[model samples]
Target: MIVCHCNSISDRDILSAVEWMRAADPQTIITPGKVYHALGKRPECGGCLSLFIGTMEKSDSLGVPAVLQNLRPRRGRFAGK
Candidate 1:
């Protein structure tokens, strides 16, 4: 199915890109922009942003890298300033 009409990006294309990226660098963060870059295309109208993201999130290989999963900023550290 076509996810981004402007870029001619398909669901499979996105999935393949995601898998390739994950394999290439397990610690890399997967973003829509990165996926677009991996596919050798860029977003045009921005209409497909939501759908593009949804497709990426649905991929089995898509996950926050383990190294980054626990890196969220703690709220209290900066609250006492």
Candidate 2:
């Protein structure tokens, strides 16, 4: 299915790009922009963002690497205190 009409990006394109990125760098965080870059395209209208993200979520390689998980400090009333 076509996720981003402006960029002609498909579900497969996003999935493939995600897998390729994971293979290239297991610790790298995958984002919509990264996926677009990997496919050699850029987002245009921003209408397909939600769907694009949904498609990306379907990929097994989209999760943050184990080593990089929970590395950020919590942000709440007392997060930085």
Candidate 3:
């Protein structure tokens, strides 16, 4: 299934890129731009962003690594400082 017509990217391409990125760096955050870069392509019209993201979301390797998650300080950490 074609996800980005401008880049000629297929669902498989996105999935493969995601898997490869995850394997290369488990802590790296995966995004459309990163996927495009991995595939050696770039977005043109920006029309396929939603679908591109949808395809990426389907990959199990797309999730942020557990170690990298929840790094932001929670609310009220500096209240009334």
- Say which candidate scores most in TM-score: 3
Query: Tens digit of lDDT per residue, candidate 3, span 1-81?
Result: 888888789999999999999999999999999999999997899999999999999999999899987777667866444
Clashing pairs in 1: none
lDDT values, one for every candidate: 0.91, 0.93, 0.91
- What is the C-alpha lDDT profile of model 2 across 1-81, one tens digit per residue? 988999889999999999999999999999999999999998899999999999999999999899987787889895875
Scored against the true structure, residue 60 in model 1 reaches a CA lDDT of: 80
Segments of candidate 1 deviating more than 4 angstroms: 76-81
TM-score of every candidate relative to the true structure: 0.86, 0.87, 0.87
C-alpha-based local distance difference test score of model 1: 0.91
Candidate 3 overall lDDT versus native: 0.91
